[model samples]
Target: MKKLLLSILSIISLNVFAQPDVKFNITSDWGTGYCANINITPDQGYDDWEMVIKAPGGINSLWGANSVPIGGGEYKITPSPWKIPIATPFEIGFCGGGSSSDIEIISQSFTPTVTEVISEEIWIGENSSAYLNTGKEYYMVGINKDEPEASLHVGTNTSATSTSIVIETEGSDNAEINFQSGTGVSELNFQNGDLSDISSLTFSKNDNGATMSFYDKINSEEVIKVVDGSLYSREVVVQTDAFPDYVFSSDYNLASLSEVEASIDSLGHLPGVPAAEQVEEEGMSLSQITTIQMEKIEELTLYLIQQQKEIEALKKELNNLKK
Candidate 1:
């Protein structure tokens, strides 16, 4: 809820002829309607004082003054003789049909006299509305709330369809919503874009030792988490560039059994394979390791085929020699 206070001040000097000191103060405004006070104080006193106001939405009721619609959103006001004396400063109050922003003082008639001055002040009393000021620096938007703990407090109890806050963006463009800490150094971002690859919603947190965790319905444990730039989950699936079926192509260079044995003896590992110590130090990716393993299996199959052909040739030569 928002409150708008409109105060129009006018000052007059008692020693010389000057403009009439008239002030308009909007004391209470509750969005759809408002109540205001018009205080008139001239340098001198007059028996009869009449003022006219222009209120586009019309005045519903008034006190301390007599009011009549002159024409075209303008009203003439005069001091109610029954309420106060004529020689002193007087105040007029009115309740208007619309917002306080619409009320304006159009004209007034008065004569000057030497009289006591009235100090200017505003009185904001209790009102039956959601907009309330509990204390200094405290504005509350709720029903039957006397005290608010925060600077701007909002409370509501309503149907299931009620929404507290909503922010949206329109048009084809990238959008981002950010939440930052009090230090202003750490932040979390929710982002979206127009392209297919970028159109998906992304959540990111930038900070030291930052961790984002998800929980089950019971919240007894963390089901998934991202900590220190790594992800931990019960299960994960990875997509790679392609499978290792290209190892079976005729253009692939397949090492013979002797060459593979020699390379393994010298390097203490299989040919084209990472060392055990290196893998332990810098880990390995599932996609890369899976492709490498599949390529080795395909090479083993080619070696078996070549060995079978040579075995068949030797068996034939032995049979011919026996004959």
Candidate 2:
């Protein structure tokens, strides 16, 4: 099967350098029809089928949104109304119904006859540092080709359940990487790779019958949460192949989510963007803490009884002295 690179870039500063003779195939569907508007979601190595046009020079003004529109071809190109001096990549896509089901990208890079990187790197801008920070906010909608899969690499912390993924900020939430299956997805993986520095994961599957597997790599612990009922951080739950079946670790890191939420470094805006911040704690630990607490109470009770006996002996000694 071929992979589709969907790039919905933020409309702004970013230099896209495309190699000459880069072939991309794209099919478009605007369910809402033409004249409908859409916004761009930007990403690096973020390839997709869309057109981006500028002020005919660099990043000046959007020339004509109506002029450069994608029709059909195996070649994926970012259209810029600006000068075509240097080989550049542009970000723009069809927006309608807010559903990406319509826009699909097919790459020629993959073939039984050949092999290459199925990726397209996008530059933040002329200045490399201009890219969005780890804490910076961005919207996302997962696409299910069949089995849903997502991967996020945080230089430090990363966590996920069957239905959600929470990325950590730099030193807290560094980077948010995701991969979703198209329509028929049933699994999510980081390709045996690792994701770190993630704060929280918020996942939803409208189709209840479909199954999803969420993978998290935090603190060298690889947790696999089959989304059907309860997970460690069960914010969004999806019914799995096992109905009424749920499993959670006897031990949970209560501070993990809070640590992630506090790390959303979106320039300090969107105060608590990480949904994990809103998850309600299950009060005292029933599986782990309760047992430990019970044991400690028993030990304390025994110690108290011994102390009481010692006091009685002291009282008897006092009477002997008086006599």
Candidate 3:
């Protein structure tokens, strides 16, 4: 009976995020609509792919190939926060699969069909979003044709280190990130990525520095981990010798906008207050949440154990009957 109950709970929990909607054929709460999620309705070849990320009046696009299949099909991506989907200042994959060598966008705030960013990106109308901080890095997966470089200046004002962390688990011993030291702020962005593909991630921070990490390519939520004291650490995403299934598409509430805007001059976030914010109130620690989850797991384990005992007793009764 306990095992049966556990199985039922597990099935119900899977729908917390990745619920399939047949109309869009996309797996997710998609609780909110998309900025623009489109694939090639035309003839698309292996060498045709373009994704655009526009913020306010600014536009940026990455070009690539073999991004999407030729025909139409439903796909699940790491939970992407449409615009500023993650902690750092980075845009998720555009996922606009077509036979176009050029990809751009405008800041007009509502351009759905146009592949490039126009002067006024239609996606971002009048929203007063913030920009990427001084040193945080964003992600871009799939078609790596146009890997854009950051026009960042890491010097006297603030320190910055930018690098791309790809989870090609098949060729590496580990898929992890470790930020040793620094002051102002440090962050990591996983644009077009997936957590399953990554076996583990080891995150650490020292002193008064704060690290804002976003794995947009992960098919879940944007995890903004903070560390204020002298010691902070996390287990790295683990990856064995096999290539695991990666689905990117999750829910994310922005971390902090004001501070982010003041820090990253390049990153641009949504206008209104994010529905979910990760700001420290009077008294709240991530440890407490972890403890709660641990307790729940413990309860589940205990329940399962009791059920196992019941099963054993049932077997014994059956044996006696036979005798």
Q: What TM-scores do the predictions have?
A: 0.34, 0.20, 0.17
lDDT of 1 by residue, 222-242 (tens): 567777878888887878888
Quality of model 1 by C-alpha lDDT? 0.67
TM-score of 2: 0.20
If both were scored by lDDT, which would come out higher, candidate 1 or candidate 2?
Answer: 1
Instruction: Indicate whether candidate 1 or candidate 3 has the larger lDDT.
Output: 1
TM-score of 3: 0.17
Residue lDDT tens for model 2, 111-183 = 1100122222322554333322222153222333221232332232335535444555556545866646575
Count: clashes, candidate 1: 3
Per-residue error at 124 for model 3, in Å? 42
- Candidate 1 lands at a TM-score of 0.34
RMSD of each: 18.1, 24.9, 33.8
Across 1-323, the per-residue lDDT of candidate 3 in tens digits comes to 11122345444444322211211122222322223332223211111223332222211222221132222232222222233212122223332333222223311122121122111122322443323221215423222323223443222222365443344445656766555546433444433223234322324445556444444334554444445643323453433432211111133232343554664554343222221234344444445444444444544455576679999999999999999
Stretches of candidate 2 exceeding 4 Å from the true structure:
1-173, 186-204, 207-229, 232-288, 296-323
Candidate 1 Cα errors over 4 Å, as ranges? 1-211, 214-231, 234-239, 304-323
